[model samples]
Target: MRSLTVVGPSRVEWREAPSPELQEDTDVLVRPIASATCDLDRRLVLGDSPFKPPYALGHEAVGEVVATGDAPCGLRPGDRVVIPWHISCGTCAECGRSMPGACRSVHRLASYGNTAGGHWGGLFDELVRVPWGARNLVALPPDVDPVVAAFCSDSLVDAYRTVSPPLAAQPGATVLVVGGTASLGLLTVLSAVALAATEVFYVDRNPRSVQTAARLGATAMLITSYSEPVSGVFDLTVDASADTEGLRRALKSTRPGGTCVSRSVYFTEPALPYLDLYASGVTLVTGPPHATPHMPEVLRLLSSGALDPRPVLAGPYSYDEAPEVLRDPPPGKPAFAHPRAGAA
Candidate 1:
């Protein structure tokens, strides 16, 4: 099997690897049908994150079941499932609270492509393994497009986590999203509008992403912050920009007693203004997205035609092109189409 391997900073290529197998009765071997690059993946490419080289490189993928061991959940060959980015025991206490991203059974940062966890390879592999298959794999709806499946494995679910709870608490609230990480902020706009946020404002320097957010129902703005010292009121503010200044501006724009969610992960200790947050009574939520519990709801919205992320998809490139694309991915969120959909 050939897998995308990161040899060093800004270096990636396809490498041969032994084919994976169903290691346990509850495990399954899947062939990726579609896969994509997430914000975290890009950070690693630039050597901005802590990961070392010579490892399989991907986290988000939608795949077809090639073989399944008989244990309990009756998943069969040909069934499609979205591979969650984290490896977790679905029955753990943290998972019960919808925090599978912090499962106690595995390493705290147990992800497919990272070094902290055991090397389980990456989603870009020709064949991937799913542990505790019944709990980890979210079966795809029959009619959902394969391309949409790839991107939603993490991006859409993370976006759902960013806005769903806040929007639920304050019905018909206004939203402001600061995008820089990747598709996350744009997807947040899509999720917010679908969930009944009255007005949505998106800020980003990338014109392509700004336009994409507009098509998804947000009023896109190119400015990161107000030039004059006027605070624009917003019911909720989400900063997917991993920059420190961007986060500062996002906090300044929030209304008192409103909610602010920062979906970006920081590699360094950023100096944050705790005094302002305490004084304003802002409800702040920031962490790695625990997307396990919300995948079902996001999939439901896609199945009903309420959300279509295909507009943001950049490719269905062949597997032969995976090396170059992973090395130098095109603008916007891109997806690679694999012929493994018919691996059965």
Candidate 2:
């Protein structure tokens, strides 16, 4: 088996590694049929991430279950499933509360690409070991394309979780997505539109990203200057860009009693205007997305053929080209496809 390893900043290579096996009765072995790069991965490659190198470097994947343990409820060998980025023991207290991403029993931040939660390896490998299969894996419907479903492991699911709950809390709310033309920002735009926000405003300087947002039903605006006052009209704002300006804009964009959600994983010290936020009476929320809880609803939307992630999929590459693809993503979601392999 080969896995994509990030040796250092702007350095990535494919290394032959031992294939993963089912180490526990609840574990399942999967062959990645399709895998995509997360926007955060670009930051990791540029040495902008807090996570160090010499580890597997992918987290989003859709794959075929090659083998499963005897204990199972909905999955089987040959079933196409979406693997969540985080490795969680579903029976933990946090997982029981429908917050598997914050499960205390599992290693904190136990993700496939990072070493934070123990090295479970990355999805950019030929084989992956999924622990707690019954609770974490979401079987993709036959009709959904593996390329589109690949994002369900992270971005799509994250988008769904970010928008749906907050929107449900406040129907017909105006939402603002503060970020660049990156995948996370774009997905946030799409999610806002899909959830039927009264108005979806995307802030970014890149014309390409702004164009992408416009095509996806968002009012794209170029951020020429940070000093300009953010139009404080939104009920909810999602800051996928973890920069200081992005955060400030998100806080300022929301109404006095509005909520702001930060989805970006910031590795640096983001200078925040605490006094301004306090004065505005803003409610700030930020965390890793609970993808396990949102996967079902995301899949349902994909199955219904109402949601199209193709706009977000910038490119699709061969499995052998994983190293180069991560180094320089073409544009949007760069998905790796294996023709011989089953749908991921």
Candidate 3:
């Protein structure tokens, strides 16, 4: 099997790897129908992230089951499924409480692509071994367009997980979104609108993303000058921008007694305005999204056609072109479909 390997900064290549076998009766093998570069993958590939190289390079993929072990899983050989980015034992204490991202059975960070995550080999592989298949695989409707549906493995649902809670608490609240490099920023803008924010304001430096935000129903602005205070104005604010300056602006934008959620993972410590944050009595949320907990709600929204991720689709790259596309994943998150997956 061929696996996409990231050798170093801006260098990606294909390497022959042994096909994964079913080590347990519960094991299953899946061939990815569609996959895309995730936010963390984009940051590490395009910039200086702490992750080292020579590792299999992707974690977001929607796949077709090709083989199943003798154990009876509700799934069969032809079912399509979303492979979660993090590994979890559905029976564990933390997992039972909906904290699979911090599952105790495996290393706290165990996942497919990154080295810190037990190096389970990325979803970019031709064949992926899924342990505890029944627990891990989330079956999709047969009619799903794998290209738009691919992000269920990570970002798309994560976007919903970020905005849902705050909006649920205060329906029709005004929202301010600070966006930067990751596709999550754009998706969050879309999610906020779908969740019925009374007003949505998006601030980003990227012209392309700002335009996309407009099409998705948000009032978009390209971040130019933050000389004036933009804080204490919005009921809820999301900071997906990896930039420090943007994060502070987002935090400041939250109204007194409102909420601000940040989804960026940064290596260097960002300087924060503690006094201002303290004075506002604002609620701040920042951490790994427990994606599984919100899957049902997000999947329902997508399947119902209430939300559309198609506008953010950049490409359906040929399987062979995956390495290059992923090296610097496009502004709109790029999706990859194997020719065998029936790409139109």
Candidate 4:
């Protein structure tokens, strides 16, 4: 088997590695059919992040189950499933509360590619070992394509989780998404639209990203200058852009008592205005998305054919080309397909 290994910043190679097997009775082995890069992975690859190198490199994937331990009859060897980025024991206290990203017991819960929690190995490999399969793996609907469903593993689900909770509490409220063409940002746009927000405004300096947002159903604008206060304040603002200034603008653009949700994984110290935030009475919440909690709902929406993520896919390439593609993805989701390796 071959796995994509990151030897250093801006360095990656496809190297021979052992094929994963069930390490425990509660574990399962999956072969990814389609996998895509997370924006965080891009940051790690560019050396702009704190994540160290010499680790397996991907986390988002959709695949078919190749084998299972003493898990449950619900999943089988041939079943197609969407693998979540985080490994969690479904019964844990945190998971029970719909916060699997903060699962307490798992020491360094592994994601597919990076070594944030532990070296789960990258989904960019031939095989992946999933622990607590019964609880973590979500069966994909027959109608959903593995390429599209792969985004659900992280970006899509994260966007849904980030926007839905706050927006649900305040129905028909305005929502603002702050970010450029990042997958998380785009998904935020999609989620906001699907949730029927009174209005979805996207702020980004990248013309391409802003255009993409508008096509995805948001009123896209460039935040060239913030001198004048933004009009039509929002009830909820999501800062998916890893920009500190953008986040500050999001906080300022939000209405009083509005919630600001930040999904950016800032690897470095970003300047913030605490006093301003305090004075505005804004609520700030930020963290790695608890994607598992929103997986079922996102799947339902994708399967309904109402929200299409196809436009978000920039291009597709063979699994062998993943290393180079990750180094320089053109735009949108660059899907990696390995039919022989099975669906992830």
Give lDDT tens digits, candidate 3, residues 155-242: 8888888888788888999999888855888899899999899998988888898999999999988866543455349998888888
Better of 1 and 2 by TM-score: 2
Quote the lDDT for 169 in model 2.
91
Candidate ranking (lDDT, best to worst): 2, 3, 1, 4
The alpha-carbon lDDT assigned to residue 106 of candidate 4 equals 78
52 in model 3: Cα distance from truth in Å? 1.8
For every model shown, what is its TM-score relative to the native structure?
0.94, 0.95, 0.95, 0.94
Off by over 4 Å in 2: 341-344
Alpha-carbon deviation at 39 in model 3, angstroms: 2.5
**Candidate 4, run of 10 with poorest lDDT:** 335-344
Query: How many steric clashes between backbone atoms does each model show?
Result: 0, 3, 2, 12
| Residue 268 lDDT (model 4) | 69
Report how far residue 81 has shifted in candidate 2, in Å: 0.6
**Distance (Å) between predicted and true CA of 221, model 4?**
1.0
Position 280, candidate 4: lDDT: 81
Runs in model 3 lying further than 4 Å from the true structure: 225-228
- Candidates 2 and 3 compared: the better one by TM-score is 2
TM-score of 4: 0.94
RMSD values, in order shown: 1.9, 1.6, 1.9, 2.0
Instruction: Write one digit per residue (lDDT tens) for candidate 2, span 1-344.
Output: 88889889999899888899878888888888889888888877777776777888899999888898877557777888889999898898899988888888778888888887888999988899999888888887888888788898888888777888888998878988887637888888888788888899888767788889999999888777555666657899988875778787788777888888888787767887788788888898988888888787888888886678888886678888877777877878788889954423
For model 2, the local distance difference test gives: 0.83
